[model samples]
Target: MGHDKLLVLTDQVAVSLATIWEAIKVVRKEGFEKLDPLIITQASSDCLLFEEPSSTDDIICVCKSFEFPGDKLLANIYGVLKPGGTILVYLASEPPKGQTMQSPLERKLLLSGFLDVQTSESSQSLAIVGKKPSWNIGSSFSIKKSTPVLPKVNFDDDMDLIDEDSLLTEEDLKKPQLPLGDCEVDRTRKACKNCTCGRAEEEEKVLKLGLTVDQLDNPQSACGNCGLGDAFRCSTCPYKGLPTFKLGEKVTLTGSFLAADI
Candidate 1:
């Protein structure tokens, strides 16, 4: 069989050397050519720094009397592991007070993008297993673009089922006729409160033509309907609702017309 490389990570060098020795014996008994087991101390920050990336086929983390590996260490381990490689985290001692070993290690493994994470507990130690994915990092593949299929509709068939005459009632079919009258209360087009319908425009023009003392003394009508009473006055007549008078007669505006409504 082909030789395989293994990584043994631990805080204690004695434990890691023992594990490597056992692994070597097992590999030799199994008739392997060689078992190159590398030991990385957890206390050293650059433990995996000298190792080639994605070179190790398997990793055994011996966590005895030491805290579980953190994210950075786990990431370094993942970087060193070959694609489809497996990692076994063996906790030889119980985690610190009020803390768990398996779950947090599993979460950290998953966060580091390990796959098929699992945990098993024994009387002496807890073992967490995870595998690196078969695909290498930074590898890219094209995703086929898909066009959604829309249901077909026939407008001609749909139009034949609809009855145009049945859609309207007698009231809806009837055209409304505007009432014929000069300022009928019900027929009068009421302006909006903001006077957006141009109704106040005429009033504004009338106010702009300020009634000076001379103009008040000798009132003149542009449309000759200023003193013809409300009935005969134009819609915008300033003298509307006033009594009829001669063309040159002075017209007095009432208090109602002078004072604006609140």
Candidate 2:
């Protein structure tokens, strides 16, 4: 229940393609075209490369009581893959004990020249799979700190331009402060965006210590990610409600966290 031709090269499958007479006998005994036979071999990847392929042929790499080199097998499969064709790489993510060496294979694949290195526990198992990272040379854009229109704050706009080749540093990913006076310091300054959540805590503490609560008291607002519930949040962690101290109508922020004092 396979293909037209049968090119069984396993030592177990003794072949006799000697004379045209014997060849024809073997061919008739098998199935279809001798040219389009299924390749069955255990040769190392290096050796596999030297072999040729027929357009309508299939190469099957089998394992029988053998531990094949993963990299070698990968090379062999790739060498024969038709341009844009896929190769099903079978591997067990779980390794034997005492092997602290996590195969850098996954990370390496991410950084590799190839596209669509599908992983199960990585993505496919999660949902509709087979997505690849695309080059966005002149494509997508995110103007977080670059534009004042963006609501996010507590960021230093100093390093807004991201170098295409540079990797994200720890600091780059960290939440930063809006430049000093990046927003107008004028009392007439209105909220371009709502500073929601834990910001209230800051206001509460400031009130407790008798500090000004101008920023948090502003009425204009924006819908932060926190389900749009009745709360002002820390620009950093918006899900947690901001702490507020209501000391005789003066609100101040005392601490930072999901659940801190009022």
Off by over 4 Å in 1: 16-36, 152-160, 179-262
lDDT (Cα, 0-100) at 198 in candidate 1:
52
Model 1: ten consecutive residues of lowest lDDT: 182-191
lDDT (tens digit, per residue) of candidate 2 on 1-262: 2533323322223332342223233224444333444544454433455443322122322222123324554454444443343332222233344642223444433343335655433311110011122332245777677645767667777858778648877788889776553234333333235544345445545455543545344332233323343355446543346444332343345445436467
User: Residue 260: error of model 1 in Å?
Assistant: 37
lDDT of each: 0.67, 0.38
Q: Which ten-residue region of model 2 has the weakest summed lDDT? A: 123-132
Per-candidate total of colliding backbone pairs: 0, 30
Candidate 1: tens digits of C-alpha lDDT, residues 128-219: 88899988889988999999999997577446676889999999989998765322323234334575545445444435555332233354
Candidate 1: Cα lDDT at 241: 68
Regions of candidate 2 where Cα sits further than 4 Å from its true position: 1-41, 51-73, 92-94, 98-103, 107-112, 121-262
Q: How close is candidate 2 to the true structure, as a TM-score?
A: 0.25
Q: Provide the lDDT at 222 for model 2.
A: 36
Per-candidate TM-score against the hidden true structure: 0.59, 0.25
Q: Model 1: which residue pairs collide?
A: none
